[model samples]
Target: MKKLYILGIMSVVCVFFGSCNDEWKEELHSQMISFKAPVGSNGVCDIYMRYQPDGTASYELPVIVSGTRDNGRNINVKIGVDNDTLYHLNTEKFAVGRKDLWYRQLPENFYTFPSEVCQIPAGENVQNYTLNFNLKGLDLNEKWVLPLNVEEDPSYVRNIRKGWCKALLGINLYNDYSGTYSTTLMNIYVDGTTNDPAIVDNRVTRVVDNNSIFFYAGSVWEEDENRSKYKVIVTFNEGELNKDGNMAGSLTIKQGDPTSGANIVPVGDCTYELIVQKHETKPYLERHITILRLEYKYTDFTSDPKNPIIYDVKGSMTMERQINTLIPDQDQAIQW
Candidate 1:
């Protein structure tokens, strides 16, 4: 009886194995695949770039996929931005988690996505798409969002569980910081209202480092309009200072400025000349004009340049991007 039972169990096991092989072959023809954005990164995030002469900035967005691809079968998947759900979702995901903050709402003319469609070739597991934007059109004053989602994969299955279906691009454009900047010179003979601030609007021949400027006071920067007698220019090492969410940093007060006619007058104990506050807030995509806070005092002509007293400077600045045909930030891609 035991021998007979063993033979019967073996026969059933063989039959089950045969059945699975046949079914797996059929299932392979219609395997379900899911698409996902790269891990640890916003499926969509904006990359800020320096203003270009051509007036445009560009970037690449990548989409990752999973699951088995059919043999000899190339599948076409559709990808687009789902505007319908974006409004319901919060855009400041990066800021909300740490500190409550909102991204800028950019204008419609600021960006251009090359294609609404992405393809998953025969066996390829990844695809990259290009996004082009107009830097000149970007207003640092406003915040923006570009949400990208994977809508359909006729050859695969939609992954609702992993929730990797979308990537939100947070746009933040940057200015060269090369133009003339108005200052608010403080802490001098008139700590708050004495010396009028001068321009730290340093410009360089090299287009790349134009955003940086020199802070120097040869004579006196009077709030009533003061000028330095000798050429005053200073150079220093830049420091990283990020508070809240701004592209802010500090430059150490160094001992020289070669480009200017003369070296910037050095203070007795002050090591740092300026603490730049070029933060981007809502409405401003980048810094149109930044405020410079001086942390030192120099003898000035205001009270007598030869016998100038200690003073600190701080000032307000303003710059506007006048490409005014503004509109609500729109979804760049539509579901297929």
Candidate 2:
């Protein structure tokens, strides 16, 4: 009985083996012989590569992949570069935990691949694949520098000096001699030059208003021993006063010698006044006056020829009441 039982078991095992072999052969004949990744998967996802006897090959590449996985499902990935001269390959080794994958294309000197395969669980959605590569054309690493300088122009300097003089000391000096007055005085000098003791008393009149003011004044210019220092003065006088005791007028004093074409130096400390009055019978009248004074001591004028003689001038004016107004102060005043 034991021998029969053993024989029966052997017979059953042989039939089972025979049936399995036949089924396997039939399935292989019908099914394609290749390795393939499931539809819609990427990274280390399974891919099928088939090589036929006719020297033809087929590959099923994944469409999408992830860098990481939540479950134990992870994919292994590898890359290779083949060129005429060289062949390089690398593999991804570690499992990615997140989905965000960054692949940058760098200058291609060699090929590299992920050392590990990416994996996704069954029934998982497929992901898109990202491919990156770089090509080398030229080298880049250069720098440049520039040198610059800034300075004031000489023409600008001269113009600035002239503008400053015009803004500060260039003014008209005037005096009226129609009233009972005599000897109106004026002075001129360089704006910043110091004065010497020898030429202090030089004074002259520059203008004479013979019409309304009826005054005569003349100007005098004298250079010091060194010819670098100069003194100029102007004076005016009124011949007589009118019957109404309201006899006055004005004059204008300007730089530059009328006879010698010499430019008068600008006086720094100068004051000017304007007076206005209304006559009962005549129209309103206005007057302007200027005065300049200087105090100088000897100094080396040869140091800079551009430097000129300096002086201070003071100017004032008095207007008579011609309108017969009640307020005396309001009737006649300086405009200036």
Worst window of 10 by summed lDDT in candidate 2: 140-149
Reference-based TM-score of each model: 0.46, 0.18
lDDT of each: 0.45, 0.27
Segments in model 1 whose C-alpha atoms lie over 4 Å from true places: 16-51, 68-72, 91-101, 104-106, 152-156, 173-336
Top of the candidates by lDDT = 1
- Prediction 1 global C-alpha lDDT: 0.45
lDDT of 1 by residue, 1-336 (tens): 999999999999999999997776664433443443343353335444555656677766665555444433455556666574444444435433422234444556777767666665766667677777876644332336666667774556655565566666666444433233433233234435555444444222112222433323522322222232322333224534456443444433432334433333434333233232333443323223333333443334344546544444333232332211133321221000
Residues 274-310, candidate 2: write the lDDT tens digits: 2344543534443322222322222223335576333
- Candidate 1: Cα lDDT at 305: 42
Q: What C-alpha RMSD separates each model from the true structure?
A: 15.9, 42.6
Q: Which sections of candidate 2 miss by over 4 Å? A: 1-245, 256-262, 265-306, 315-336
